[model samples]
Target: MLLANVPITVINRTYSSEHKLISFADTNTLLEICDKFQRPFLHFWTTEQPTLILGINDRHLPNLAAGLKGLAVNHYDYFLRNSGGLAVISDPKVLNVSLFIPTATHNYSIDQAYQIVADLIQTIFPSLTIAVHEIANSYCPGKFDLSVNGQKIAGIAQRRTQRALVLMLYMSIAGDQDGRSDTVAQFYEQGDAYRQDRWHFPKVDKATMTTLANLVSLDISVEAVEDQITTALAAQENAIDLSSAPELLRSAQFINEQATQLKKIQLRNNQLPIV
Candidate 1:
């Protein structure tokens, strides 16, 4: 594995119980910073708020008014994230993990990157029989969707630039997977009326999604799995803290700058008229 040859120097960040938009922006910034510096990073965060995140390629709902009203009814704030996927639901029980690596540094092909991420996940939960394949009825269906016992639990998405690539995945740790799926399904029912003829959103089946708690015999709390992630990372390569590494000080500075830039971009985006 290419990951085995490289030292796991990560800039760790946690956004537990934080706004989804803020965390999304921060993750976006981290990807840029890591790419700019040609460094590898591991980022983990969790969102407590129920939010519906739309993919950039997703159809912009023609009737956003009804979509916004539907979201308000379900107590889900909505936003579009800069990533490759359709609508996905997130709550406190879901844990989002992202890996930012320089494609040139690692000589990574797109397939290789997906394999590395799937391998890392298998490393985290070694006891379980995890299968990586597409779930046709699942929301955000993809070839890299991780499943166990014929149930989809996590979906992987990637964004590749000239120098950097990000493998972002979300795991259903412990939550009402059915309810979350239903929420997204209904949101589409109301929002599907509006279309940009861009991408086809899935007609999600609530039964297609499952959580880790349901799949594994042992406790699979977000914190427990998070600890497992760090442990697994340490076993694979030396994991360092950003503050402790003086030689990589510039990466930290770049992250700060990216945060500021993202805030301004988000603000400008929000100000744009929805047509």
Candidate 2:
């Protein structure tokens, strides 16, 4: 309900921004960037190459070959993302946005983060028929899925490091939800059937999920979503471009150390690594 209270002042910050999404064959570089940049930024890009992203602690494989590679699904690779949440489909269409908000600016609980997203979407389509409620039985179900008529349109996850909290979520702009759910369901099945461990996969439903393009009766492209994010973020602060930062470059060794230590200690209570 507070979605509209996201001060227009923040939205009016630097009307022009240079936020661009870069593709990845592996998530290591992205993770490195996220850990290194202690500021707010956004991007929307995807890989032409397929990589089956495993949860940080999703080791139903237990060091065994898992995902498409193990099943010989052809051309698909398997690697872990340095974050929370289970598998979902990612490509150019699944527009990904990361907002690294300083805790000092606003203390964010999970709900507050979702509210920020809800507010942004509301800004884009102020009159669109939609609801920001939890979608039950959806893949990676969280409190922040923007839905329409009980079908999910997004899944959100937050990654916090020290005082900076990064909320990473996907707006499935155009894709086969049923197809993506099938891939996740099969991955869970394979990981469970092949490895001798009890692990939980996101309960994805082919019918309960969809994309923004599908949610609205309009034809939406990933490029459109990218523009919307640039707009929303520009409203927040005088965003600096992602130019080559020597200081950021110099901090890599230390950043990697922090990341490694975080991952090593994150695997508690039988949970997978966060990446």
State in Å the error of residue 95, model 2. Answer: 1.0
What is the lDDT for 156 in model 1? 92
Off by over 4 Å in 2: 1-38, 61-66, 70-75, 193-198, 235-275
Could you estimate the TM-score for every candidate? 0.85, 0.68
* Per-candidate total of colliding backbone pairs: 1, 11
Q: Write the per-residue lDDT of candidate 2 for residues 131-228, one digit (tens) a residue.
A: 87677667667677777778877767776655556566677788777777677667666656334536545556678888777666558887777677
User: Could you tell me the lDDT of residue 242 within candidate 1?
Assistant: 40
Q: What lDDT does the true structure give each of the candidates?
A: 0.72, 0.55
**Candidate 1 global CA lDDT score:** 0.72
Q: What lDDT score is found at residue 79 in candidate 2?
A: 48
